[model samples]
Target: MFFFKKFFKKKKQPVDSQQTTDRQSVQSVSKIDKIGKGKSQTSRGLIKSNKLFMAWNKNAEEKKQRQKSGLVADSYLKQISPKKGFTFHSDYFEVGDGVAQILTIVPTKNADRQLPPFWVTRMLPRGLGQNVTARLIQPISTKTEKWTKDNEVKADAAVRQAYGERKVNDPSNQDIAFQVQDMHQINEDLRGGQYHGSEYKILLKAPDVETLDSAREQYKLRLKNNFRGLTVEVFEGQQKDDFENLLKSADAQIGHEKKMYTSQELAGGYYLMSKGIDDITGKYVGVSEGDFNNPAMLMDVDDWSRNIVVASKFGPRTGSYSTEVFGDHLRSISLWGVKIAEDAMIQNHRVVHFILNNTDIEDIGKRKIGADLSKHTSNINMGKGAINPFEAFGREEDKLNVYPTLTEKLRLMFKEMSPSLNDVDLNKYFTQLLKEFMEDKGLWKPNAKENIDTISLVGLPHNEYPLLSDFSLYLSTIFTIYQKQGNQQAIKSLEKIQGVVDRMKEENGDIFDKHTSSVVDNAQTIPQVIYDFASISERGRGIAMAQFINTLGYATQNLHRGDVVIIHGVDQLAPEVKEFVKDNLQKLTRRDVRIAYLYDNVMSAINDKDFNDLTSADYTLFSAMSSDELEAYKETMKATIPSALENSLISKDDLLYYLSRDREKVLFKLDLIL
Candidate 1:
């Protein structure tokens, strides 16, 4: 899903019910009903051709439908999809007929189904700032009108506790700083008067005078009676004014609203704009763009706190690094240096300075840094560890539903296919072939010899860049295959090379991963991984490719038959690789994956003979770097790698001298190929 602040942009592309989606994804919404009568007001505009999928937008005809359906003006709420993505197994409540909202049942563990208390928070008119909401429920039983109010108190408390415990936030600060403007513009754009803040009392409270006085104390301390204005005499029934008042409030009681997905949000790494609150300095503040670590306003906040005047605490900023950044889509890659001013800010990501350029480590290793000059630096040691621990994000691979047994079975079939596994003397050759078989399962990589460890691959004489590291596992299988599978010269050359290691093979040295060995130990290798791969029915291949190809992990439940999967970067791949991907992807449909031939990089380079087939379904490459980007990347590497080395063990002169005298080139800038 993509996030854009412009609400109107969503209208350009309504959801198509025919879109292929597994049963659970709410995104695969098939039908939408209007909140009121007018069967003709169904989602007729949503049934558009799939050609628009190229842009991958989430547009809707919600406003036009809202007008045509002539539903109550307040029925559509704010028309903003909640931040939390869709979810299933969550209870939803119906209102009258066609509309129902996703319900948030609380006091979760001890929830009493008989009296299960659920809460719903709807978006309010953007202009109001105070607590402008009231909870109203149409009871299904003799649950007293008082129960609705009491339920709301409990519900509101539970919601607050839930937010604190989950660290989830809404657009509170954004509402304060930008609401009035958003309200005015959205009001005109949506062409409705019900959306006006005065018409809705979303933040007003129906408290008695005494209740109002009690809540006003805190605001007095805040030097503003903000909460008091939210109180209003309780409105007992659902009147037109009541509906308008509550619609403008800060919260809502779930009623009817189908075709909606809501849940508590789970963005942990960085939180920029949570909400805006009055600072002791007596000004509203919420930052939108800056490093999460130290924005320009941080010092101003610090200085104010230290002085005798106003003291303000910037609750949090408006942007997030884990979730967002300014201008969007900065894809390639670069290394940046970090300096932490305070230990408390350790986890914050700061993209500030470029410290090194020549990123060519081969050149750096030749000359040593200080005492460590005693040995060459290894990528294993210098390679940065994997980024943040994503477990909290619900992406644990172990927990990911993978087909471990079938995956192993497929591995075993690979071994039985190798020609030399029959003879005891071929045991050595069998083991070597086993490794090749497994490596071949990683289709995203080119069909060539590759070390299981990627750093080692780069250490080879000629290594491809962009690393192709993400999907390496997808193309591999059981027994390692011959360098050029089924080629006689390559096979003899392989045996001849292993023949020299014969004496060593006599000793027991096995390289199978525990899980891999268990499956292959059972026998029956496939004729060859590629042949087996190609021989599968297009139906089965589509299923396997979709299921197995994931950045999350190798193990996953097989995709159901007919499920489509898209292979990216296909057009830009080397000729042979492109053909293999295309041959395998024929059975899938466009809905499975977008077969784009251009990405951020160059899309049409005159240099490649293969550029003629820019529309080939075989390639995933959307675009390649332009001459300028490629040239800049190359130029940056030339300087950065050298600067990085200057700070390393050896001096630049020593590295150049060593490169000029001993090595053909001390370091080949890998990205130089881009």
Candidate 2:
């Protein structure tokens, strides 16, 4: 009966045909309308309807489940898994498209200690399943040197060789043999040496416990046999401390030796200049051959070579040393003497004088007395216009006093007599004085006084005599020729010696009254003698005056007259000063030296201003920049232009422009331009 029902019964009877036809007609009309309007069926609409039905069914199921579980229909699980086989509880899948699944996995026993933390939802395959079910076994300490049959034979040979036929009784030999038997049980120790010998020690470290035990035994054996002669010292750690101590000791020894040798060499000493003074027959002296061998000495070549030896020859007088004589000579030695003295002073020594006059006293007295004073006294005693001897000597003294009454006159006489008194002459004069003084012992005899007086008159060495002599000869020759020619003009022009006297007065400011007055009087009178002998022009006379002015050290001041000198006529002036003088030569010709002076003053001002402006501008520019920037600017400027020099003048603006341009260009090249 159930089968018949299943086969024959219609599923359900259709509704009225007219009504269904009406419904189909309605659907067809709707489709036709939709097609006519270009509108088509939307999958979104179907999906929305399907989604609604599914959502409703899911809600119903969720409600049923909630009824059972007492949870809300819109719970988190329901939202995540809406359908069967897609439930959040079964698979636990992440719901959102972009959500990442994070699993916190705790470590388990049997996991490899080296493995990183694991993740249940891993990005990569878990490697080898965490190395589980495996255990690390402690390694057995095997014999480091395996004793194979052949190895054993070699070891036996080594032991025999090292033990040197080991005796059974000697304990040391037995110990050494035992050490040799275990060939691999030896350690190497290397050390450094002092002097010529080598001391060896070594350091070793073990990587494992087995290696550590083996190394210990080996070290013991090595100390017994291989290093038998060496002292075995154990070092447990770093050897840097020992090495540093050794290096310090070595350095100390080396420094000590170096210091010792240096001190020794310093103390040994060496010559600084030439070896001085071979003999002490006289006094210690420093003499130059030039002075002693001067041509004016009139001595034979051999004598002249030894002529002016300035020995520390001592006279009978106390403090009568050659140094004093030399010093006096150095001082009064004329212009050349003054120069030499100045040079000596610069070399750090002072000079004094001890001059010995060798003039004939009787001749000097006779010359003073004019005609024979002895004959005059004899005649007076014979009753021929009687004159007292005292009066005669008095007249002689007065006459002697009349000729250039000044110390310079006495100095001049000594200078003239200098060349005559060489070492031999001085020695002879001293010997004579000693003889005279000895004869009149304890009584100051007048003759003894004379002898001592002659020796006492020490002055500047006559060493500079030639210069004075040449000067005198030149003047005398000029005077003699002029007088013979009677050329008053030449004489007058050349004879203006007062110029020199005035210059001397200007320089010294009347320090020596007698000398100054005598020189001035002589100068005034000599021009008359020259004028009578030669006739010279005004320009010649001016040149002579200029020369005289130079001799008195006032050439520059006097010729320029404290104004512009128009040094165009003088080649000796500095070129720059000369140029200034020449540039204003026309003004000088206008007899208005003030114009030249003004030009000089203006030039000085301009130069000073130029220098100041350039310095200030440079300082400003340099100070404005850092050291590196200043250096860079200088390099750039140097590369762009020629060197700046004193002779070259550039306007301040132009220089600044150059410097600025260079700075800008360099900065721009370095990308530092602001």
Candidate 3:
């Protein structure tokens, strides 16, 4: 919430004062009053949907509290006493069901030199033992020293040298060392109270106003009779002034909330459970204690996506390192994947469900009171041919690859693969739908006339599919975040490639002008010339394969160890596809990358006995229903039959939806079309 837009040092212009203030003011108000009454009226939080969050967090008491909290959500100054350093705090808080109190201490005139007294330090919790229990009070930060970079480097060098040639930055060992000695001091004043940071670091916490006062009296005595004695004060909250101010300055960052679970999210999770997902050690949530037992009301889905069904539960803090103990602590969870589909023949409703997840996130707390975490619910669609992405990508070599019209190049790719990359093809119309990507400098266009079929022969990079240029986009270091990256020579090479593509586009402009749609529509079958606009001699320089690969480096940015991905919808797998998949699969598996995919395409795409089965028992298979099957189930449910019979026939929605009676193409796999 404290993130501010970095200034762009562009040419100066006369700024509109009101416009700028308004832009910043809205965000500030929301942030500042995040825990107050105004927050409820304009209820925005880390979660994607408001209705879902309220269902989990909002209680009858808060509804009334919010009305009052609204008055102080902003720095109205009118309601605040308007004292110089004494802020008029509503002391608003979003803490779990309990009284909250903020304890403030005015430093004595000699406070800068003075340290925590011996008597006070003896009472504090030392991180070493289990007996120091946290109850009504939690001391925030208390620091008397700053860890400078110079000292850090010295510490690192010393620690690393001690390990005898071992890497200096072993994470766990480093963390433990840093936590213990880095930038910390043994407070002699408080009989060895370990403290950190440069400021007076007088901040502390208590559960209620009374405990705060008691803690203050005990500490204030140390500064007794000073010229300006330590004056401890207590307030109603624990949020920092800086954090509140940041929220007040920003516009709404929370996602729009929806009222009810979309038919898909609920139906999908429920159906998955029926398929034995109940054993996944999952979390069940709802508005109340009984809700977990009664799963019907709590639509189970979770993640950062907007306007979808989710299980009922309190969310966690948005900031992992920063704590906002004084205000609303609700946060959102990053979801697996989201898919939108129509119920088609089943109740004619819209369905939004979690995709790619094997089970819902495990609920760590009970349903009744309140939870400290800011997490959300999660689930995956488990239909026929369903395989867990995690299990598929269990070995690093398991791979997921996407190809447009793998005719020959696809073959070469397969020849390169190891045996590991085996995942089924979902065959939704997505992998071929063409992604809309653009470089700010327009690095998407490629030379159609210059085919890079052979890495050694091509003058420049080109696409085999002519129409791919129109729907075509490319990754190059030019306009992407990679712009201005690398050494001068590397940059020059990219520029040359850019020039080549520009020339190609220009040379073919006349053709596009005449046959735009016709040419693009027939990309797969079109002659190579349709894509390549000029001769290699005319194009001058060729873009290297390394350049292309370097540009695509960002694709792996989100990947991490043990993270899984499913590459689906690449239709008609060929030998090259297999080879490429295997090769990458092995490579990724070697690096612990996990993957998964549908297996149906093997039946239609690969009939050769020489090829090994990629979709065998190493992975679990879920028989998800296609949209046709869902429709049939829906129809059967709606048929003039008993409720018992209706429930038995419709097992689950396979995330497949038929746009019409006939299947509509699933463009980019953004939507599900059976």
The best candidate by TM-score is 3
Instruction: Put the candidates in lDDT order, highest first.
Output: 3, 2, 1
Off by over 4 Å in 1: 1-557, 560-575, 587-600, 604-613, 616-674
Report the C-alpha lDDT of model 3 over 473-498, residue by residue, as the tens digit: 44342235345554554344334434
For candidate 3, give the lDDT of residue 208.
49
* lDDT tens digits by residue: candidate 2, 8-106: 121232466653333643454454445445455477765655565565567667767767775664475767773433112221122233111111111
RMSD of each: 30.1, 44.8, 30.6
lDDT of 1 at 140: 18
**Worst-scoring 10-residue span by lDDT in model 1:** 335-344
lDDT of each: 0.24, 0.25, 0.27
Candidate 2 deviant stretches above 4 angstroms: 1-486, 489-496, 510-674
Query: Lowest summed lDDT over 10 consecutive residues: which window, candidate 3?
Result: 665-674
The digit string of per-residue lDDT tens for model 1 on 1-674 reads: 00011111111324568766445223323322222223453354334323233222334354356556765544564344333432222222112212222111112121111211121122111212243222222211122335433543554454445445543355453433243343333234333111110111222231233333333333223222222112222222323223332333222322321111111111111233312222243211122121112112111111111001100011101222221221121122110000011111122211111111112222212332112211311121101111111111112232221123223322222222232433332334434443343344331123232422331221111112111121122223211354436656546644543432231122211111111222211111211010011111222322223212211121111222322121211222333223323432332222231111222123222222243233222311111233353344335324232443233213211101111111111221111010
lDDT (0-100) at residue 499 of candidate 1? Answer: 35
Task: Write down the worst ten-residue block by lDDT for model 2.
Answer: 665-674
Instruction: Write down the TM-score for model 3.
Output: 0.20
